[model samples]
Target: MATQPTMSEKRWLRALGATLWPSFLVAAGASIVFFANIDPETLRLDSLPGIEISRMSGYAIGFFMFWMVGLASSLLTLLLLNPTPERGPWH
Candidate 1:
């Protein structure tokens, strides 16, 4: 018979898997909304009413925000649902 996974191991696996796709979805959705609402001409620093930061900074901030949110959520879920230590198959 196969041994069952320990609670810690299961928590870790779930957290890692949960972090990927949801994060991507949020990031993509935000990007779409940002582009849709903002004027294209304002995207450039050399143009009138242009943003101060370079274009690369926007991408970096988006990526960082997505990753941080995903990671934090995953960890919080694991902590909240953490399993108590097993007392054999009896208890």
Candidate 2:
């Protein structure tokens, strides 16, 4: 017979899977936006307007930021919803 996962394990697995894909999607989308907006030839420091700076950096930073946020949020949600596992030598 196949062994069933404990509830907490199942929950964490679900959360991890859910978090991973969405984070990847967000990162990919942001990278796309970054590549789309900024001209490689015109990557000068003084060329960017204030708003453009925010938008451009948002694309770059948001990619990683959102990914981390998604991962952390999912893990936190899992932790909040599931009971804590007991620590042991094997655990």
Candidate 3:
């Protein structure tokens, strides 16, 4: 047997899913499409010569960077969708 989640917990989980799931999917597709055209090794060598980063590591880093951007976009959209209360002293 398991206990049911409270309403707040459920809302939190829903918000988490809403934010992450779509972003993850978009990041996966973007990674494939972008990396297909651009070689990470060449990009890294051209951009950063001092650091030693492998091709696979570059892909991972790119994916995470895309994911972070997606997350920020998603969060901003969420914030905009939420209703703002009116500012007043009396209700």
Top model number, TM-score: 3
Candidates' lDDT values, in order? 0.62, 0.62, 0.83
Cα lDDT of model 2 by residue, 22-77, tens digit: 77776687667765786533553455444345545545565677678766776566
Better of 1 and 2 by TM-score: 1
lDDT of 1 by residue, 1-91 (tens): 9999988778656666776667677767766677667544455543535447655665666557766786677557655664555533112
lDDT of 1 at 63: 59
TM-score of 2: 0.45
List model 3 lDDT by residue over 1-91, tens digit each: 9999987778778778888988888899999999999999999889998999999899999999989888888877766666565622111
Off by over 4 Å in 1: 1-11, 39-52, 83-91
Candidate 2, residue 66: lDDT: 61
Regions of model 3 farther than 4 Å from truth: 85-91
lDDT (0-100) at residue 42 of candidate 2? 53
Clashes per model (N, Cα, C within 3 A): 0, 0, 0
What's the residue-level lDDT of 89 in candidate 1?
19
